[model samples]
Every structure is written in C-alpha cells, then in structure tokens.
Target: MPPFDPLRRRLPGGLRAEHALALTVLALVGIAEGQRLGPGGRTTPALVASWLLAMAVCGALLLRQRHPVAVGWCTVVGTGTYYLLSTVDGPLVLVPIAALYGLASSGRLQAAVTMAAVMVIGVGAGALAGTGDVNGTAVFMLTGWLIAVVALGAMWHGRMAYAEEEAALRATQERLRIARELHDVVGHNMSMINIQASAALHRLEKDPAQAESALAAIKAGSREGLRELRRTLGVLRQVDEGAPTAPTAGLARLEELIASSALAEMTVTVKKSGAHDLLPATVDLAAYRIVQESLTNAAKHSGARHVVIRLHRDDAQLRLSIEDDGHGAPPGPAGHGASGIAGMTERARALGGALTAAPRPQGGFAVHAELPLSDNKTATERSTR
Candidate 1:
C-alpha cells in the first residue's frame, strides 16, 4: 500500500487542507470580532455586515491556487473595506496574508510584491489619516511580516522549480541509458544474424554442409537476441518489483561474445593482462559493450577479416583497445541514436571515464577506452559474499 499523507486525507464535504485553512481563519476572525463587539456595542444590522465582510475576505482564499492574483486583490479590497466600516480591529488581516503567500508560491513574484506594497502603503496611509485602528508601530510590524512572507514564498517557489528541473534531467538520462542498452543488445546480435543469413544464402546449393552451419549460427543468434530483449523489456516493465535475477552482461561473457563474431567470418583475438574478475560491474559492462560494438561495426561496415581486443587492468582503471585490420568506415552522424560510437563514448564518460574511436594511420579502425575502477574492491567483496 502507498504511504498515508494527512494533506491527502479527505475532510468533511470532500474539503481539502485549503478549505480547512479558510474555515479556520473565518472562525478565528469571527471570534475576535465578537469579542471586540461585546454585549450590545453594535446593532444587529451592523454586526451582520461585519460578519459578512469577514466571511467574504476569508472565503476568497478558497480560489487562491487557481486565481491567485485575483483572489489576492479581492482579499486586499475586502479587508480594507472591513477595517473602514468596522470600528474595532480583528484577525481579518490573516486572510490577505494567506493570499499573498499563495501568489508568491505559485511563481507570481511581481503580483505578490505589488500586492504586498499596496497593503503596506494602505496601512501606512490609514495611520497617517488617523483612521480606524492601525497605528505607526502596527504599520512597521505589518511591513516586516509582509516582506518575510513574500521572501519565504519566493524561496519555496525556487526550491520546487529546482526539484522539477532535477527530476526532468534524471528522466532524460534514464531514457538515454535505456536507448544505449537496446541498441547494444539488438544491434550486436542482429549484425551477427545478418552476416550468417547472408553466408547461408550464398552457399545454400554449392555447399550444403557449410550452409547448415551458417543457418545454425543464425538460429542461435536470434534466440540469444530474443532472450536479451525479453530480459531488457522485463526490467523496463517492472514497477516496484524485485530486482532481476539474471546477471547483467559483462567481461565474464567476453568469450561468448568473441565466439559469436566467428559467424561473421572474422578472426578475433583477445590479449589480456592483470585480474579482469576484480573489476567493478560498471567498468566490466562498459568494457564488454565497447568490444561488442567494435566487432559489430567491423562485421557490418568494415571489410575486416581480423580484429584484436586488448584489455589492460591496473589498480585504478581498466583500459580497453579493439582494432580491426579491414579498411575503416567513415564516421556516422555524431549522436547516440545515429551510431554506436557515440553511445559507447557516452557510457564511458558517464562513469568518469573516456573513449575515443579513430581510424589507424596504416589502415582499419581502433577504439580505445579508459574506465575507472573506483569501487572495484568493495564490489568484489560484496560479490564474494
């Protein structure tokens, strides 16, 4: 069940907190006015008029959220009229103060500032005219209170806007992450499957045995692609669900990845140094994806017959290099959605790492990535447990 919130709880007549606040202000103002007009100080008609004005001033707060500026002005005018007619002072001042807060909190700084200025000036003017109940000291206190309320409301508005901006930024980053995952998963397998299918078609009648092997590779690639796709989609579909039981793709699956490239008729070699198993999950996954994308690019774009993957692990970082002998392909548009290179670069940079893809001066293409191993020791310990 979702957590309970008092603000969300329904009040009588389906009223919310705003309605409750308005009613509370009304009651308090009414009681203060009643005390001011003790016994038979005022006639029945005058008493009724005073109560009606108080109700109107407080009732205007109900529509403050939707029409804050209008409600603010309404309360200001109503409160001014109440003080003008009524001989004694009451708590009717709370109504306009609430409206001012509503205006400022809704990002209406100009309107709120103007309303506050009007209230302060009107109170000062009344004091100078020796009117109803406002004295010089009352004007000074009222000015300070109005300024503080506007400042608080503006601060609240800024905080809320910052939170919304941060939420949007996080959402955009998540979408990019999902896009990269789908591209790497689907692109790598599909490239292998396409190569195998082409090979099978070419040798179908001429070499039936070789054709059968190619078809088998295509079948395996498709099945693996579908499994990975399902796993990815499953994680996407989860909402308040347990974490996925399947392990994420990482360097441990590097051998299987290299084996798949053989179906494309490419001889791929891996040269490694240091302990690869001690790498952090993020670094491991990034290294695996960099190699996978490089091989996929070679199979589809470059006419490469041989590829070399080199991994060098140190205490602080994991360095990866994937190079192909085939002539390098021209760079695609510079964006994650256009080519896998941009996606790989993004993944590396996201982990406080760096990646570069460039054609070799002699021939072919090479991709080099440096991924940090910031939390590898802790991650290794946790994995062992």
Candidate 2:
C-alpha cells in the first residue's frame, strides 16, 4: 500500500478538500443533534431552517482560502442570520471558527482580528437583547474562544513567515558559496594563463626557446584550469552523476600553486613558522581560497615585483598574511577588487574566523586571516608532539 498522506488520502484532494471535510464533520454533528431532538422536536420548521443555514455557512467556507477577508465577512453575516431566524440555539459556531482559522492562515491577520471583534460584540449584543436563549455564561465562553482562535491564527502566520525567510536565507548562502568556489577556481588560473600568453608574445621573435617554454606553461595552465573548473561545477550535477574524486586544494598544494605563478616580473615567496598539522578541512579550504584570491588580485592590478605569503600556527589558531609591495588603492571608491575581498571575508566569517584586506601604510596591499583550530584537533596535535 501507498504511504499514508493525510492531505491526499484521508481527506479529499484539491481546493474542495477542506470544505468536504468540514461538511462531513458538520453532517455527523447534525445527525447527532437530530437524534437528540427526536420525532416530536425535529418536525419544527425553525429547526429545519437552522440546519439549512448551518449547511449554507459551511459551504461558504469553501472559498475561504482564496478570498479570506470576504469569507470572514460572509461567515459573520451568516452567523447573525442564523441567530435572527432560529428559535433554537444549537451548537452552530464551528463555521466561524473554521473561517477565522483560514483567514489567519492566509496571512489576513488584521481582517481576522476585526472579524473576531465583531463576533465578540455580536455575542454580547445577543445576550443583552435576550435573543433566543443566549446567556451571560455562553457570551463569556464564546468571547474567550474567539480571541483564542484569532491568537492561534496569528501564531500560524508568524511561523509560516519565519519558515519562508529561513528558506530564502539558505538559498542565498548556497549561491554565495557557489560563486566563491567559481572565483577561486577560475580567477587564479586565468591570471596565470594571461601572464604566460603575454610572455610568449613578447619573446616569440627575439628568443624562440623562451617562447616555447612560455607556450608549454600556457598549455599546462589551461589543462589544470579545466580540471579545477570541472571539479567545482561537478557539485551541481552530483545528484545525477559522481563528483570529482580528487582531493581539494589546501595548504599541502601550496608548492604547486607557487610553481604555477606566471605573473610578469613578480616573485612569490612562501614562509612557514610552525608545523602544518591537524587543521580542520573548512579552515584549510578557506585559507587556500584566501591565498588564491589575494594572489589573483595582486597579479591583476599590483605593480609590485614581489609578493610574500606567510603561514603560521599556534595552539588554538592558524594565521595567514599575504602582503605585496604594489601600488596600493586608488583615491576613489573601492573598485574591481570588491567581490574578491567580500568573498574572502564571508569565508572567514563562516568558519568563525576574521579576514582583513586593506592597503598598508608602507605602500602595499595586505590580506590577513585568523582561523580557529578545533579543540579535538588541538588536543591531538599536543599528544602527537
């Protein structure tokens, strides 16, 4: 058997489902009311008209989801009509409760509140005017129920709105993560390829051997760039097929990244001060991205001849600093490097770390990040040492 779906199986499907369920419950209640009245009381025309009005109000609730405010008004009007015409006051309040719930669920809090107020007022007026058998206790009980129903609807609306906002926030974060991955994979490799192509063009006629070496570097860079692109994009298609099995680039691949540098007249240097061990994968990936984005920016805009990347670690934190002796920021607003800086900042923040990229007072630009080490890994590192 198919799994039980309360919405689809136990209840009828589509727009009429709520109405159908409501009508069924009302019918069962009406049968019980008839049984209580018996043959002598049931033959009255007023009693028959009251039952008909109740059914009509229940039918009006069918339109509640699509036209909540109008349905609320209609429900109030129908209840008043039933009160004015019926000599007997049976339990006919279910219609208004259902209508109010629907109104509140549809995000019509103001209308639902107004209708609930009108209901309370109507109950008070009925009791005061000696309409049918409405009394003080009935009025008090109904007023409290109406207020409680309205409050319940408000809570449902609040919960629904909160859920929607959370879903939208998750979607936005996913997109930002994808964009950062693309920037890391594409930006660094493209800059190196551009630099190599420039070198090849400059030395093609004057020095054929150097030109050939530049071409070889270009070929290698292109291949590596393609592989990295596939690795990043494969995540999107992972549900359909397997993603790349190759390990992601981290500090372990720092040597290969430095060797692949083709920036014009720039020497990249890497310095380490502590043993690189027991770093969380998140911090490792974020550190690698910070370094990659920093290098890409320096290669593209900085007129510096040398860039220094320093990596260090202590008992509780891993620290990174990339400083370049380049033409610092221009005089105006933050320009082309804004996205890269923002991406790096977001990555650091996500991992409970901090990153800062700014023009140094010493005529250069610097990017720095401090990533935390997990407690378990810190203990393991101490034990191993």
Candidate 3:
C-alpha cells in the first residue's frame, strides 16, 4: 500500500488540508448541536450563542501551526464557555483535541500536557456538579483520546527529528569521502610529477635521453591527474541533478598504478594468491585508493627503493598487504602519513572491513586490510555481465 501523506487532502481553491479539517470539525459540531435541539429551539438565543462559540473554537485551529499554544488555550476557553452557557452535548470537544496534537507536534509537550490535565479536570468537575450533559464514561473516554493524540504527535515529531539528523550525517560522510578521493588523486600525482621533474633536472647535464623520458612521465602523470580530478569534481557539482554515470577507479588499474610508482624510482611488486576479480565496487575502489595512498606516501616521505603489494582472496574475505623498505613511520612526528592512514582506516571501516598501518618488526612500514566477501551477489552479477 502507498504511504499515508496528509498533504494529499488539499481542497479546491488552494485551501490547505488543515483548513479542510477545521471546516469538517465545524460542520460535525454544527450537526451535533442541531440534533440536540428541536426545530422550535432553532432561533433561540442559546442556540445562536452556541453556534458562535463553536465557530470561534474551530476557527482558532487555522492558526495552530504558527501559534499552537495560543490556539490550544483559545479552544479550551471557547469549549468551556460553550458548555457553561448552553445545555447542548455536542462534538465541540474535538476542536481542543486537535489543538492538543498541534501543540505536541510543535515540541510543546509541557503546554500540551498541562492543557490536557486542565481539560480532564474540568470535565470531571462538570460531571460532579451534575452540570451540562457530560457523564463519568464520556469524561473517561475523552481523557483517553486526549492522551493518545498527544502521544501520537510526540512520536511523529521524534520520527521527523531522527530523519533530519540521519540526512545530515549522510551528507557529512559523503563530503569526507570526496575529500579522501581528492587527497589521493592530487597528492599521488603531484608527488610523482615533482620527483620526475627533479630526476629530469639532475640527468639533463649527462643523459639527455633519460631526462626526456622523465619529462614524458611528468606530462603523462599530470594528464591522468587532471582526468581523475575532473571526475571527482563532476560528482560534487552535479550532486542534486541526478546520479553520476562516471566509472570509479578500481584494482583493475593496478598495473598502471605500479608503472606510475616506477616512474618515481620505486620498484613495486604485486603478488596474488587467488582470483582478484568479482569484488564489490565499493570494496574494489577502497582497496585501490589504499594502495595509491600508500605508494604516494612511500614516494614522498620514505627513502625506500622497493615495495611489495600482496593480494590474497579466500572464500570469506580479500586481504591486502603493502610493505615498503623505508625508514619506518615516514619520519617526523605524525603529519601527512598519519592522516592518510586514518583515511584508509575510515574507508575500510565504512565497508565493514578493517585496516592497519604500522612499522614492520624487522625493517619497513606495512599496511594490512581485510574486506569480507560474503555479500558478493551483486558484485558477482556485475562481473559476469
């Protein structure tokens, strides 16, 4: 069944749903008042006064959204006056009940509760005094209705608040994910270009051919970096338009990544134990980014000449290990390397996985990550296609 949306009840001529509800309440109360009096009593002063009080009580509801407490009190006073001046038993009580819901939904819980208590007491006192047409049973039922309406309103308010908070949290996480992507793309390529430029300058005096190769590598890295940057920015700019159709980077480009690291004078090796394809897209992208960031840090901070990357896939999970023969922990008190590691850890945790980076006992720095492969139905389907 479709969900219940109150806004669908809008009347003709742009009348809001609340306005319709108020008019409906007014009509029902008028009918009840007519039933209470015969045709001979139609033109009586008491009936005229009762109709006026009912209109005032129901009309106040039109402003309930803007002034809930005031409208609630107005309905309460109007209902009390109607009962005191007239001997008719009618549905005018519903007006105050609706006002109580408005008050509770507006986060005015104290005022709503106080108003409900006063209403219950007033009805009970009227029954005790043998005034009006209210009895013990009617008062009891009205009290229950008032309590239930207030509770439902409070629950609706809480649900809306929770939904808003969840949306804000998702927006925050998306921004952080984009930040990590930018850092990986820009930082890695810039480091490679800088290193290649230095190499070209140093080799220009002796080996002209090697210097030209280094310059070529710099141009290639810059071009690739610009492509990736544009792709990431595209997602940010068109977020509200629709879903982006750009393909994300994945471990399928492992060879290209390794070649880029080699251009920076680092020998990178890849070892695979099992099938490496058919992983979920999210896990694949996160794994690729982890490797890219690790390589970037190695090129920029570590004086390592060799790095080994291992990928192991079993029935349960995919494991990644990247180790570099560098001066442990990337020198200096935790700065860029620390933030990079933190970002990697966040990515893994977001995917229900785990990642750790630290200095290996024997010599260099190592990063280990584990991503589960249990929920691979969708990924498997995509891979086969």
Candidate 4:
C-alpha cells in the first residue's frame, strides 16, 4: 500500500500533542491546588480544589472543534455537575473558543446561532454558581472570550469562502477563452479549404496544372492550420507548440474562388477598391471565409446564374460584399436553411467585425461583412503567438 499522506499523518500527531498539553496543564493545576503554602497570602484547600476541577473540565475540550455540538454539550453537563456536586470552579471553561470555531466554519448558520445561544446561557449559569456572586470578574472574562471566538471564526471562514469563489471564476474564464480560440481555428481554415477546392474542381479539366497547384495549396494550408491549432492547445498543458505558422493565402485566393464558381457556369465578377494589401491575419482570414461562404451558398442553393464580389478597404476597415441573383435568403430558421451564413457572421463578430444579410428588391440576396483593423502591434502578436 502507498504511504499515508504527510498532511494526514501530521494531523493526528498535532491533535495528540494538543490533547497532551491540555491534560498536562490540568494535572499541574490539580497538583498545585493540593500543595500547601507556607504562609498566609497563598492558596487554600477550596481554591486548590476549584483549580483542579476547572483543569479537569477544560481538558475535555481538546476535541471540541473537531466535534463541536457533542463537545459543547459535554462541557455543559460536566461543568454543571462539578459546580453542583463540589464547590469547584466551573468545568470546561476553555472549550467555548474551539466550539465557536467549528460552528462558524460549518456553513450551518442556524446551528452556529443555536450553539452561540447555548454557550451564552451555560456561561451565565456557570457564573451565577461558580463565584456565588452575580457580578463577578469571571462573568466579564467569559463573555469577552465568547464574543472574540465567534467573531474570529466568522472572519476566517469568510476568507476561505472568498478564495473558493475566485478560483471558480478563474476556471470559467479560462474555458471561455479556449472555446473562442478553437472556434477561430476550425471556422477560418475549413471555410477557406472548401472554397479553394471547389474553385480547383471547376477548372481541373481546362488547366490541369493549376488545378494541381490549388489542390497542393489546399493540403499545405490545412496541415499548417492544424499545426497552429495544436500549438494553441499546447498552452493549456504548459508545453511549447514549437513554431507558429505563416500559412500563405491572402486576397489572391479571391480569383481562384470566383473562377471555381464560374466553372459551375455561375458567372462571377470580383471588384476591389483602395489598397487591400497587408491586413491583419485574422481580418484577412475572416474576409476570405465570408466571401467563400457566400459563393458556396450561391452554388448550393441560389438559382441566380450571375454573382458579384466586391472587396474594399480604407484606413480603418475592410469591406466584403457578395451578391447573386439566386433565390433571396433561406426560408426559415438559419439552421434549417444554410448554417454557413450564420457561422460566418459569428466568425466576423469574434474579430470585432460586422456581417449583414438581406433580400434584394429585384430578387436573390446579398451578404456582406465589414471587419475592424486593429493596430499593427496587436495583429503581429496574434499571428506570431
């Protein structure tokens, strides 16, 4: 069998030490009370007996915090008996603090309150009997210690509860972060591959060499993206994912994308305005995927024979618009019709981009997305990381 845990092994030894110390104190007080003093200013037989009795009662308290309710009641019964039977100090006066610590930490608010009330009543009764004087210093001391015990216990328990809550929150946030990263990986890569493959298939007979090139790019792109994905996941295991990827595809894929759709005899026109080069990887990937989804949907469902794809960029944003004379938007629930359009929107929104879809007045439908351009530094960090 495996060895016992260090903490658990130490626990029993610590408890034994505490119990032994309590008993030793009790025995010393008992013996001291039995000893005779040479002169007048010293202890009497009654005082000695009271101290001995108090020690014995206090010794019962060693396990009070471990079993609060049981120990507390034991203290009350033993202390009350000793007070009534012999004119000795009240039994178990050292127990209230331990019982209070256990009660507050238990998470049983009602039980703690009930125990507190019992302690107050028992201490009052002990005071009334032990000193035979209602207004005595012993009453004040007991009351002060009881209040301090309960307060300290409550504070320590509160700290422990807060720590548990913070840990849970951190775990939840980490899960959300991982979910978002995985979404980007799977969504962006698959959309591009599907688009490029469709394009290559369209011209495969006419331009066999180019078709082969596109096919090879598709394979290489997918492999590189998968490698990057593994690296992203490796962070969770605290392992290095090796090198980051520079999986080469940009605005150039738009031509192959449109040309492929044209192979299906669906005429496609692509237009660009302003400087569209050197975009953030995420924005570029999102733009490609959005247009890719639009073209794919046109081929899959739209009856419109002609398509228009427009790409535009200014200083702050990149714009993509795709329209076909195909049937206007799917009939009902997004999931029931085509799921890609909605997924594209979600992908765009993840990068602080916007997507819109609406029916055309004449016929068919149009899909467009505008993505924000984060500063260069942030984009570089995302790509390299």
Most accurate candidate by TM-score: 1
The true-versus-predicted C-alpha distance at residue 71 of model 3, in Å, is: 1.6
Scored by Cα lDDT, where does model 4 land? 0.63
Put down candidate 3 lDDT per residue, 47-72, tens digits, no spaces.
78988999999889887756778988
- What would the per-residue lDDT of candidate 1 be over residues 132-157, giving only the tens digit for each residue? 47799999999999999888877777
- Candidate 2, superposed: residue stretches over 4 Å from native: 1-17, 29-48, 87-91, 262-265, 328-335, 360-363, 374-385
Give the total clashing residue pairs for model 1.
0
- Backbone clashes for every candidate come to 0, 0, 0, 2
Off by over 4 Å in 3: 1-15, 28-49, 201-208, 237-247, 330-334, 375-385
Better-scoring candidate (lDDT), 1 or 3? 3
Supply the TM-score for candidate 1. 0.88
lDDT of each: 0.80, 0.75, 0.81, 0.63
- Residue pairs clashing in model 2 are none
Q: What is the lDDT of residue 219 in candidate 2?
A: 90
Q: Per-prediction TM-score, please?
A: 0.88, 0.83, 0.84, 0.54
User: Total backbone clashes of model 2?
Assistant: 0
Model 4 per-residue lDDT tens digits across residues 1-385: 2332222222124466557656765665455445444377487665655665566567666765456567656655555544544433422445444545555654544555666667667657767766574345656776777677667666656666765555555565457545655654555456556756886998699998878877876786587558657755765653445553444445656776665565455798888898846888878867876776676667666655899988899888898898889877664664422456666776677676779887788888899888888742322234334
**What ranking of all candidate models by TM-score puts the best one first?**
1, 3, 2, 4
